[model samples]
Target: MADEKIKKVSIICSKGSLEGVYPALIMANGARMEGIEANLFFTFFGLDAVTKKKVKKIKVATVGNPAMGIPTLIGAIPGMSAMATWMMNKKMDKLDIPPIDEFIEMINAAGGKLYACKASVDMFGLEKDDFMDEVKKILTVGEFYALAAGGHIIFT
Candidate 1:
């Protein structure tokens, strides 16, 4: 592993929530700044991070999140998810973290590639236009793996 130079990184995002998506975006953006080729592939519920409408509003996970200290049942109560999401976003904003759309734009402008999982897109009834304009294409898992060969592959 020490002998290999990391010329590229492919990140797989499988969760849709803000907690899940931001890490992938941060890493991808960081990779490009380091002169490494970066590709972000959004799959399953992670599609929300790439979808034009939902990306900016991706919420924090409240239900089933033990870190929040709320019982799962209580966390699942109406408005709790929104409150958590709002709190997280407020913190992120104060920290100067750009919203998801701006983050994607920055990465794309810096040459990072964005892709959506074809299966997820189909399952969600999303067309190409449903994704952020920066997304290069939608690819199957097999196709994604083939493209991801020869460098580090990270799952977030």
Candidate 2:
């Protein structure tokens, strides 16, 4: 009998805002739940998702998102971003979903890997000190591909 193989998964998150950030986290966490070895690599705007200072402060954009509908209009109104963010957070809370920061921590605790893109770090003028401690390393695209090569690679 052959031993079962565990799947390896790689997720690249390139967008910065709330809508962009959550999908990556949710997918990565879901992969972990399925017993896969999952790696989430943050590049460009997605870097905010792993930054210690910025992770907890991620907010939803109410304006210009077609999916947000009514909230989009509300977001277009003055002072609506704050309200939208609050309501979004409240909805997540009601569903027992932890904040993105806490969800990231849970994923880490489950042995998922987190990485930052070296190129993006330099482009954004961010030092290693700017990210959270959970980030395993800052890697080049080639290095990221080495890990992603055989696995299912997803870009969010």
Candidate 3:
């Protein structure tokens, strides 16, 4: 088993925050770059990364984020989340990290597959039209598992 090579990667994104969503995207992108098959599955709040109206507006979660090192009171201030998001974007821009919308396009262009969770779409009352053009399909959990078969599964 230790000698087995990874042939594919199936990454699940289940959070909506900028910080929450990027890890799965980055991993999928990296897997493709390594010549491994890659699939990205967006579910629950993570669907925001693929939703047409919400993609560009995803923000970093300031409240209840322990990694941020800020007190809950401070993080809950009206403008704090926006400020943190802006700062993060600025830093990422300096480092040449693509925004979520552009990142999805890049992954698609590189032959990576993109999917939205069927249950999540229904729960959010979203239609197929609500997703970005890069999303290839809406899949039930079983369907996703089928696609994820023989691949490493990662949830972010």
Top candidate by lDDT: 3
By lDDT rank, best first, the candidates go: 3, 1, 2
What are the per-model numbers of colliding residue pairs? Answer: 0, 0, 0
Better candidate number, 1 or 3, judged by TM-score: 3
Model 2: lDDT equals 0.87
Runs of candidate 1 with Cα error greater than 4 angstroms are 1-4
Query: Per-residue lDDT of 23-137 in model 1, one digit per residue for the tens?
Result: 9999999999989999999999989988888886788889988998999999989999899989888898899888888998999999999999999899999999998899999
lDDT score, residue 10, model 3? 95
TM-score of each: 0.92, 0.89, 0.97
> Which residue pairs show backbone clashes in model 1?
none
TM-score, prediction 1 = 0.92
The lDDT per prediction is 0.91, 0.87, 0.96
> What is the clash count of model 1?
0
Q: Candidate 2, residue 155: CA error in Å?
A: 0.5
Candidate achieving the largest TM-score: 3
RMSD to the hidden true structure, all candidates: 1.5, 2.9, 0.8
Q: Is 1 or 2 the stronger prediction by lDDT?
A: 1
Encode model 2's per-residue lDDT on 2-119: one tens digit a residue: 5856588899999888878888888888889889989999999899988988997787777778777765556688767777788888988898777878887888998899999999
